[model samples]
Target: MSRTKTRFAFVCQSCGFRSPKWLGRCPGCEEWNTFAEESERVISGGSSARPAVPYPEIEDLSLSRIDSGIGELNRVLGGGIVPGSIILLGGEPGIGKSTLVLQAAEELSRQGLQVLYLAGEESAQQIKIRGDRLGLAGKHLFLASETCLERFLEEAQKIRPNLLVIDSIQTVYTESLDSIAGSISQVRECAARLLRFAKGERVPAFLVGHITKDGALAGPKALEHIVDTVLYFEGERHQNHKIVRAVKNRFGPANELGIFEMTGQGLKEVDSPSQLFLTERAPQAPGSAVVGAIEGSRPMLVEVQALVSQSNYITARRESNGFDRNRLSLLLAMLERRAGLHLLGTDVYVNVAGGLALSEPAVDLAVVAAVVSSFRNQPLSAKTVLFGEVGLAGEIRAVSLAVTRIREALAMGFKSVVLPANNLPLAEGVPKVELVGMSSVLDFMEWAG
Candidate 1:
């Protein structure tokens, strides 16, 4: 009998880069003090060749999705949950990731679907307390406090649940790995095993993932690639509204947004998120501009607020919340060069109201409007909504779904819409609203004045 030799290697926790020796800084992610030692077992044996199998024939099988009984969650998932798919849900601590999943599990159980929830982070009693508080019956919802991947799989096979949920994949470990739980090797192996089980059993599984301090998912980047969908739950802890944004999906459309309100009962779906976002807007305030934004298939109206002030430091500070900083810099340069806005020696701060992050280019005009409005101390029309892409030459470019955005603005009781000149013809048929089209940013400034 030959003994197996063991080898140890240092792994970067951020990117899963492996090295023979430990280092102060990881070469893969350039993160300091992220390398940790992990053990690997090498078995001494001759290479064995395996026969390759032919490709399987494709079948015209219809895959029916399971309704989670949560409209907001379903929207983010691009519909209901698909069978035999693995979904990864990540969020910051105390941002209601576990609460959202628990509510979904209860809803599925109420629909007579067997759901096995493996609690790796909390005890069964703790989950029960939360479930009971959330008014869950738990009739078909099975709870198991297990952390070992192999044992969980064995139990799952015996019960044969329709859905499986691991309350955080960080705590789950495999016996084959010598590294502790939550390590790079452990997370990778455990997720791979779970993926196989989900595919083989044709059971839809949900894996709750932990996010690092920097807000990225805390594991190897490959972990996200192995999953079928990745949903990010985002919101401030102090805020009442929570946003679930889909960053990746294999069965549905990516970049879908789901809105929910955190309440004492549980998370309740917000049907009209636009109204919720603009409920407390100061209509008469300067530096505030309303933008008609489209999130996924849903159209919404959001407020963009900006503040410009004299710089007290040597270099002016440029800051943005819920918006890209680099993009803000580009817009500032455009304002200075094309729009003749002297913002070079001033501090500029931009924020998308209601904790919602806007990334689409349609919001460029609104951001520029808000910044200029603040700089000139002029208040924009409260009932006027803006949506268009601002070019480097100060041109207002047309955006997609112009009619959709116009309809949403109309529904929100906005009287007039300031849009790109090219979209005016497309939206001319939209009645009961005035369309103010601008060919350039300079034209918009003159109109505003």
Candidate 2:
């Protein structure tokens, strides 16, 4: 037999660039002294067992999906997994990214789909030990502990499973690509091959992606553009709750989010997000207030907390977590200039409880209330919820979906809602809920006092 042709490749380690010949500087990205060697290039076979079928005379215009039984995950995936779709899932290290996918695969396999989970990081026995703990027992499900793309493909073609999951893409190696497995060139190429296989064979594939030090999907920026859906697992790992947010979805709305609480039984859906927000609430605490913010169509009532004390240093130690510090400073300045808040000697600390990052300006009014409540040693009524945008002029400005926010508060048994006066008429005959409108932040303070 003729010897298989092998070519050399020079790859940059820092920038992840691959070249046929060694170079002093990388042409793709300017990183020095990072070039490495590759002996052979990955090759894609010019063959397929299945032939493409022509579209029928009857137009197929709608999507078809079988539920994965996880409502939260389904919502993020644009209503369950679509056949032949490839999803790129990324999260910080040790953030339960692998666990969530593995659990979903087991559930799908039990639902009569031929599922195959190929793990490059762990062996088959290792997967089973965890699976046993999860009580995942399926007769039709198959597990492979291989990492090479060629061997995985050979087994995949033979099995022809309905659902496929590669534990991670970075650990997978392909001889067709002349670069390291996790290199930009290799990753992009491997993903392209798998995507083709998915589309051509009508197999839904889930690939776990790694995040870089900068907390973005690792590999070339182009990798993000290629995937149909990108799901991010976000949360403080120590926290019981995990938020899977859909940063990009071709089939669903971008603002939709999924909430899962990690437990002994595995990740369970949090049906009432409002309760979860108040789980760790400290009642009657100064600088603590309930705020209703609308995220997409969902309304959430979250607690905003702040701490106030005398400043010793020249800089008043103004800091905020889960909320923007710059915005916090601006709000403080507005309070001083527009609302007459004394800030020359006071230190302010603010946090959005439960490790959530709140960027919605609707929380502005709440932040102001919490800070003032702390400063004045007062607490907002537990039965009340506040919603409004704070302007540079200290105006209690209007926020979007104010009516919806009020309705959410009402549904959560809140008796009154503080809102902008501009939001009037109240969604046509809403009853039993009091709406207190304020024109300025000072007006709100007086009402609170």
TM, every model: 0.95, 0.85
> 1-449 in candidate 1: lDDT tens per residue?
44477789999888788999999998887888888899966445654665765667543112588999999899888788888888999887788888999999999999999999989888999988988889999889998888999899999999999899998899999887789998988898888889989987889889998884374446835488999899987657679999999989988889899999999889999999789989989988999999999988889999999999999979999999888899899999999999889999999999998888899999999999999999999999999999999998989999999999999999999999999999988889999999999999999999999
* Model 2 per-residue lDDT at 235: 55
In model 2, the number of clashes is 6
Off by over 4 Å in 1: 1-5, 42-62, 220-222
Candidate 2's TM-score: 0.85
lDDT for 247 in candidate 2 is 74
With candidate 2 superimposed using the best TM-score fit, by how many Å does residue 72's alpha carbon deviate from the native? 1.0
Q: What's the TM for model 1? A: 0.95
lDDT per residue (tens digit) for residues 1-449 in model 2: 22455667776655556787788877766655657786664343555577666768533311766577789989888788887778888777777777787788878877888888878778888877777777787566888887888798888999999888887888787777666677766677677878888887888888887675354334634466777778877657788998887777776777567888987767889998888998889868889988998754588899999998899989898988878899999999998888788976899999988777778899998999999999899878878889888899888787788778888888989898888877755543567888888899989878988
Top-TM-score structure, candidate number? 1
Give me the displacement of residue 415 in model 2, in angstroms.
1.7
